[model samples]
Target: MTELLPAAGLTLADEILLAERLNEFVQDREAFSDNTWKQLLSVMRTGSRWASEHGRSFLPMSRADLRDYLLWLQASGRASSTVSTHAALISMLHRNAGLVPPNISPLVFRAVKKINRTAVISGERAGQAIPFRIGDLLRLDAQWSGSGRLQQVRDLAFLHVAYATLLRVSELGRLRVRDISRTADGRIVLDVAWTKTIVMTGGLIKALSDLSSQRLTEWITLSGLIAEPDAFLFGPVHRSNRATVALLNPLSTRALEDIFARAWREAGPGKDARPNKNRYRGWSGHSTRVGAAIDMALKKYSTAQIMQEGTWKKPETVMRYIRHVDAHAGAMVDLMDKYASS
Candidate 1:
């Protein structure tokens, strides 16, 4: 194994020391968020399997092997962005281990570039969540009012706040009772202390609509989380064991996604409003955020206004949602009739 060392003059003992330093650096660095950490681990697992099969260590894998891995990923039908992310992750891991990443190789870089160009030319777009429109919210609200169950009340509050605020599921899960305040106008305002975008700018304020405020008040009165300022705003409800409903367990992002899915199924169109029978398929936690952005676009709001409301720093990112709506109802379409008749 000593003969396999690269000609870079790194001794076996120096390699061990490098590994130790990397581990220490990882420990001291701020941790990635839960979802991001999970994604990184998944990418690592795939890369590990490839390295093992090729009888090579990830830290010292050859450029050819990395290029092959990217080709394999593309062949396996991974989205272009996902393939790019896997490449980026491999590069980061190699750098962390104090070695040159294979992605810098011309072969690997050209492979990535070719794949990206192919995706663009083929008109391949990333899959988007089916946004929950304002009408869907009204229907869900009606259903919750008739149910009158503790879980129903909680779901109502969550949906109302989530849609109105357009918060990501992770942010919604992190909401605390103390972060909420009532404005003099009777609206509920959320003091978002942390967000993916606001990590540097500190925090921002989001004012909930009147309907959301009413639902939140009802949820608080029923769930009894109002008494504990530190309690999670959207905690779990033990429907099976009613005694545990008072326990303030923070809901996971997956759980929040489930809530969204179930609500979407119940409120969407279909016979008896059953899951999978509705028009609202492919909806997820991001649906509300997408829907809100499109709604603003339909109301003729400018790009800047939509970006600020959605907390999107990138105009291109915000444009994706606007583009989806524009494809059907943009001003260009409205002008077609005038030109066609001439």
Candidate 2:
């Protein structure tokens, strides 16, 4: 193959290196897949093409070039948030340029503050734990069945474990059968070796064990999951002959989001619970995880204890989920009254 020309000192080989770095970052953070890296590369290529057609090939790109490319994406009907992904990728390219910026010292700056949407809502600038409820979860269980598809049983099991263990959709989707251990009584136990949260100190990070072991066992036995350990715990719901095992691929994260959207619709809204006009305030698959956290909190589990079940490293992330469920707002008042009076 002919060598691709360089853009901002990134040859096709350098782009590959950056893609590797992107993969490591995503995997380490338990984020999206390698496909996201390809999207970022496409963004770079688009910017390079614009520059080339305009006769501005240079070793380092100007901020103007980046801004123009972002404008192009916006004009193409991308959302502000999606356009921001391209901006972030471009920023990473500048950081990886291997040369220091003019008059700037080479020093690393750690993330002192990540975005805290929950904190903003509570009239504070700190992250709030997302809130989730058991009722909401039962409703989601119903929504999974609404698809009326073949893998309905398998999909239900997947949704149950996700809600019961509060697994991030990414963790839930990536689970291999080997990641689960079966107890003598035939219960399913999950050993989540990786999670989205970062534990800087590292030794003895908390985990969820057998949260839904009993239910999982029932689901597996009913679904006839006798596959080998290396098989995917969840796969697409398709049909096949006896000679070929009909296997399902892991659902994409985007697909999971759509599932939640469908659930929110089926659950509908309380008569007076409109978030804005016709829009309902709180509902989604994320509700599965956040709702579990809120249920535990309302059950009087301490904040730290809730973090253990939710597998949240920081109280802040847990707090975000807490706030999401707090949209109803009465639970906290009762919680405060009971605790404060005590």
Tell me, by lDDT, which candidate is best. Answer: 1
| lDDT tens per residue, model 2, 1-342 | 323223345667776765665456556543434555677677778768876877764235554455555566656655454565666666555454432221121111111011123223534332222233567556656565444343554545665777777877877776766677666765566766666553334422222235355445544554455564555666554464111122456667776655555545556454544353233364545667777787887776888988877777789877766664446568788888889999
Across 152-208, the per-residue lDDT of candidate 1 in tens digits comes to 888889988888888888888888888889999988999887676766555878999
The local distance difference test score of model 1 is 0.77
TM-score of 2: 0.57
Which segments of candidate 1 are over 4 A away from where they belong?
1-10, 29-31, 120-123, 240-249, 270-282, 328-338
lDDT of 1 at 171: 88
CA RMSD per model (angstroms): 4.4, 8.4
lDDT of each: 0.77, 0.55
Q: How many backbone clashes does every candidate have? A: 0, 19
